[model samples]
Target chain A: MDSTPEFVRLWTSHQAEIRRYLFLVVPRARDAEEVLQDVSVRLWEKWDQYDPNRPFVPWAIRFAYLEALKWRQRQAREKLVFSDALLVQLDASYEEEVPFLEARRRALQGCLRKLGDNERRWLWLRYGGHGAVKAEAVESGKKLRKVYYALEKIRVLLLDCVAGTLKQEGWSDA
Target chain B: MLKKTSRLDVLLGRAAEEMLSPEEATELEEILTRDPEARKRYLQYLDLHAELEESFQLHAVAGGLGSVFFPGVSGWRLWTGAAACAACGMLFASVAWAYATPVIQKAQRRTIFTENFEDRLAHQPTGLPRAPGAWSGDDASVVGAENGVLPKTGNSMLRFLRSTHAEENTPKSAWCDIYRLVELSTPPALGSRLSLSASFAVAPASDGEQFDIYVGLNALDTYPVQAPDLDTARNLSNTTLGRRLPATRNGKWHELSVDTQVSPQTRYVLVHLAMLRRVPGPSPSHVQFAGHYVDDIKLDLLPSNALPVKTP
Candidate 1:
């Protein structure tokens, strides 16, 4: 029996979640993506060994965690965001919060639409790409503090809105 | 203490923006280790940043490429043959261009009319006391809100004036209306949705009277010579009035809008901005229009049929 078909379906569907988990453990986004590529290849090769009874994500995430740890060792000491011990502890906590995080991510899409036009633009410039926010601030002659203040307000609003939506849908108190 | 709270907040903000230095990163890790609450806050901010980064990233989906691809290369070296690489690249580009010809068109919003009251001289040509296309009714002028708080866009807005205009509203009106007219040379195609959006603002004393505000639209072949009684009298079958709700007294600009399909017969659209209770002190009137204003009126047309799009 070819496990490639089922494995491909599962991997593609949950690739973003795995990438997000890797981002939490890996400090740099590019580093996370590099580790993610290796993990994908590793998972593909080991698909036949995966036990179908257990949850696919928790099983696959373990591989990602180990791969990220290896990548962190290859990086310069200054690049690591946390110590190895702290990363390991946080990985366990993140594994339990996967479902809740998925819910919050979905709610965030709706909350994004509720933001004002300026907030959306600022958010895109700040996070959409490297150095985009600084370029915009300099070109527009806006104070850096004012830009950060607007972004902070938007984050708080989205967090509150996401919490309210989750409550309304009986997702969680958060 | 606010000092400690602000410390965690600033660190989280720096992390989310990808601006944290190595030193700050160490501080952040120590704080997260010492304070569980700080750790939770860090997770929330990181989660938001991660999702945002996901959305910002390029999403390229290439379908049906597996069968057409050449066999996987072994120990590929880009500099091995530059001339051959250029030829191969051209071939791939041509093939991809032909295969990707079928594109999905994007939905569009066409702006028909937009006014922020910055330019007040553009009045509708009307031959009546007050009509839909022209700024009708009494005691309303475009003035800038002091302290720059009320106007939706620019500094200027249309304020409902109460100077000797209370007597005029009583005869046949319950609204002080400002009019804007958009005349279409040809009626919009069927199934096209005409959307009207306008922002209203008000600032009143806590004990001040309540003033009602409404937005109305009329789609007709021609403008009425005389201004129609917008609230009290039954309007023509083609009229649509927004709900008569009390203006919020929170000193914020609130947006109100009305959207309806433009039938094949609609030649002109009359946008009406009306406010009620514009008189002074007691008796027939309770709350007077203290700082009731309207600004930033816009008209948009969304075509249902697939249209040409420059953006997706």
Candidate 2:
């Protein structure tokens, strides 16, 4: 019952993976973050139930999945949301992408540095400042369509850069 | 030259922004099902979006990543800026530490037992009886939520009161000793350090009322009968380790943390919160006064390295 040290180690090691898994399951980042907190509490409460013989990531992911489902039920009235089947499909794909996503996260700083000054500023306005695309457009005196397109372009560039960096570092999907 | 925007790219962008309509979502699903390349690209874009969002949150918590990503800043200036940022970060962290030291200190120690007196009242019946997890002296009555003293954090607090009725020349002591047994799975070994802490407030009705609060650890099997006097309670065989706290007549909540050595043959520690009152009377009316209001009682077993080094 006194598994504090073991639980801390397991939780610290799998926190990022849990967060990413919740993010994939839940649509909104806020909802995903809330579910992450729930998952943390649930993990602590059920720490004694965890089997040391098995891998911790999958065990943690099961808790994350349950919490995400609970969150989805709470937000059932929201629009454009995925069904349980679709979520299961996404979760399956997410499990496969966890390793690659970690590498991409590592390469993100370099990729962000490679962005153009204007692109970086736009990114700051949108993601960094947490301003919406419309807000960015209003702030920069650009049309909403133009802001959206610009952001889309910047995202594509970042994605391409991350892929290139990973490939250069000899990271392949296979 | 800029590459033309593909349908998949447009769908991915809308999906990232959560702006995809039902029609667009259906089309995107069709594309994802039909083309493996589109599905791969979609997952990658989603992953990138999540990474960027998470990075922003991380940067915000780390006091912003502005200095590291400033455009056109040269080597010396960057180093200087980084150093300045580091200095600012240190300053900000120090201030945060000052505000969060108590919470950080509590979080660092492993809690062996904690009772906030929040849930105990709800489980108690209507009459003034002992709390669910607490055992009180014969003279003590645990006031339930209805007439209970207001809690520091939760809905109720452990209100210990003793009333003395002395006829002419009889000088008697009124005391309330409340203790709860905290069964530990891995009990502290002999000579191991432990800490007992609780916030208490005394509300003496008159100047003649004297309040004494004692917090301590006792062995599980050793049950000590409630003693009428403070000296008798202190010298009890069950009380392996304890400290008598100073009276707080100001009526403000004062926190008392006592460090003591763990005794042998202790599978569980009894966290005792005793409120003793010595009332000297030559009065016409019965003297009534509240002894102590206790809340947030906690006991922690300190790690060996956390113990204070004794100087020779």
Candidate 3:
């Protein structure tokens, strides 16, 4: 009936996108969820600050990034020492691989849907605990690095499948 | 223009992606040194690369963990959202309208009571001799005495004296001793507020002197233990005393009394006295009133404990 409806619709529509953004930015799942709650509250409080003419994704991403960074700083302060430099390097790599990154993420969604029950369970097991590579390396008696490289290859295949799905969506450049 | 722009753009994109190895990082730096345009392009790509990386990371996260993070618009929470907004509005309006009238009135009354409160004494001599009996039918208030005049102290100032070796050349007068006219005027109850006021004067003595005065309800053991020093004690205001009484210099008048609560089982009362003096030299500026020099002190008592306590 009023601007409230439009605002609520806009916020609800982007909830998934914003949540996904939070997951990638915050390395820990629980911390990411906490930041998601904080970001949602801040968005509601400062909803008037949003410019309807602009893209919501980028606007929402900016707030999410700040919240995630604050969480990381809090973690760093509590723990006393952490390898922030490694995160910086990985972030840099992500930037360089943006074109392939988006394609891979899209392909991952389709790959998840297409996975058979066994394959889904394998995917879960791989990322479930310490991650597939760590879990397998322990059992296979293979070197940790070798197991990690094998997992990396598997990730690349899944990423290729995500890219293929994006191409089907007419995202040919992806 | 198109060809040149295309060449510059390709180089810029490569630098942006950090497709540069250690050797390439050095080469890019060298190119930045040689050509200002190339350096500008390199810096721009670096900036864009940082922005793009942050964006990609955010997007990837949002895509993967959207549902677990935000629980996409279920139901029932719709009412909660509306209620919160309405409550916020109500809270703001109520806060804006609130005014603290009772608290302000209480603070104002406290300030007035503290400022106007006083207990003072003035010296008005009977001009009578140092005798054992009342000053010749001088009718001033005393509980058991037949006449109002007080019995004079022997050769001393009749409980109060004027100094023979006067410092100010002021005329000597027979000073009277100020006594707290005591009776069971206070009710035997807790939390009873009472105020008593009386005035008296000190006569110049052979040795420069001061007076000490204290008021105690019931026995002298109760209340704030000992009296505060006389230097800080002030006489009651003219409004409180009901009259503008005569003044004294060497035979200066001073008024002193205390305002305190009446405790349970209060009966006997007494006024403790001590002579005060001002020590000379690099001494303390403390003005001590050792003896009493008061005449015809008036007492007014307020009954503040009239209300009986309701038992729970």
Candidate 4:
């Protein structure tokens, strides 16, 4: 806890992951940052709450979930808005990404290199934003379905490459 | 099982992005409970989704945005950022695993509540001397078993409208949401009048009638404590009465304020604006009826009885 340098380092390394976790949990971009900041502050204040032995992701998730709930509650009282069903839906949607991010990223790097330039760009465009796809589809004069299928094929190729790399990396257990 | 796992993976991906159908979601939940390995795989997949999201973060754009694999960049920066994020992660992990005590947890929970209160206040409408957005229908029938006024039932400030017609179809006196009644532990000191300086949109129904605004003490009075009606309410020299602003072209925000006098007797003083429509007229459908998007409302509560006015 005394090591400010260590804390800053930790924040840098996991900031992306924390941001990702918050993005999954929060609907708005701004809210995700707020959650991340709140989580960081809470982590700082309650440094004693952490056990050095455990993984950080789960703990961060717990904090993120708590923040998300508080966000919901605030929305409820101030706006007196949101139906129970919508709340349930939002909760269900928030944290669906707990398990495979690291391995997949590791796997994806090897496969992403194998893609053709166009395919890589296609992947980037498809995953970029809905606007990107709409723009690309119009420019290419291609049906949305065709663009979707092409993207899916590229994703499958990448997944296959990743799986092959994992095998080479001795992840036979997976 | 493999087929089920495959389907789970696809559904899980969609679910991470909140594009899953209801039926697919139900299946996914069932798989989560019954299959541990599948659940593990799903969690791993969620991590991937997180990575994808992080890749586009603004901070990720540091050192000139381009591809993740930009050439001529010092490897040290990557290592440093990685080390920093990892250290932050570990510090957080240590705190969560080691130091979290029950006493600390309770205190943290209270702090969370307080912060939540402040954060929420940013978007909440201020209550009047009585309370902002208080229901004013007749409540003499529900007499209290104890001292003070019997608590009002139904038509609570927080209510879920079943449909647009729920208000009209429902009984006029129906309490929309129930409030938790609490007896004050000590003498309830009069809170100072909140200096209201915020915009509130007031869109009347198609009939062009406006919602009524009031400042009053308690809920039983047929009229407001300060302003009996709109014209009278507007004419008060000392009061902070505002003319209703026009609707936004694409729903622009509005602001209003009231720095009224408050006293210990002002147990229930308030400034309220009701979105009322003419009988058989166009109903101000939804929250838009009150002529404003009341969400993301902010209120600053002043110290109690800090009114500048000298009461006679």
Best prediction by lDDT: 1
Indicate the residue-level lDDT of A8 in model 4.
58
Q: Which stretches of candidate 2 lie over 4 Å from their true place?
A: A4-13, A53-55, A70-78, A132-136, B33-36, B60-68, B71-312
For every model shown, what is its TM-score relative to the native structure?
0.45, 0.47, 0.28, 0.36
Candidate 1 residues lying further than 4 Å off, grouped into runs, are: A127-132, A143-149, B1-5, B56-312
lDDT of 3 by residue, B162-226 (tens): 22212223242122223231334444345443454344444445563322333222222232223
Query: How do the residues B43-128 of candidate 2 rate in per-residue lDDT, one tens digit apiece?
Result: 78887888887665454333334433533322332223233333245434433332222122221367877777666542221111
RMSD to the true structure for each prediction, in A, is 20.0, 24.2, 35.3, 24.1
**What share of the reference contacts survives in each candidate?**
0.18, 0.23, 0.00, 0.07
Model 4 C-alpha lDDT per residue in residues A1-174, reported as the tens digit of each score: 254554454455456666776564453456677778888887777656765323355576677667766676766543322233443444454333222234457567666566666775565454433246556688779997667556545544555566577556433333
Which ranking of candidates, highest TM-score first?
2, 1, 4, 3
Candidate 2 yields a Cα-based lDDT of 0.60
lDDT of 4 at B303: 50
Give the Cα error of residue A6 in candidate 2, in Å.
4.7
Please tell me which model should have the higher TM-score, number 1 or number 3. 1
TM-score of chain B of 3: 0.28
Q: Cα lDDT of model 1 overall?
A: 0.61
Residue A160 in model 3: lDDT: 41
DockQ of 3: 0.01
Supply the TM-score of chain A against the true chain A for every candidate structure: 0.81, 0.80, 0.59, 0.59
> B1-312, model 4: which lDDT tens digit per residue?
011225665666556545556566567666765665665555445544454444422122222112332322223333333234432443333222221221111111001001111122121221212223332221111211122111122111121121123213323321111111111112223544434333323222344333322211121212354423322322221222222222221222233334433343322222333222222333333322322222212233355433222222
DockQ of each: 0.08, 0.10, 0.01, 0.05
**What tier of docking accuracy does candidate 1 attain?**
incorrect
lDDT of 2 by residue, A12-69 (tens): 6568767877766675577778889999999998877876533477798998988877
Model 1 clashing residue pairs (backbone): B209-B287
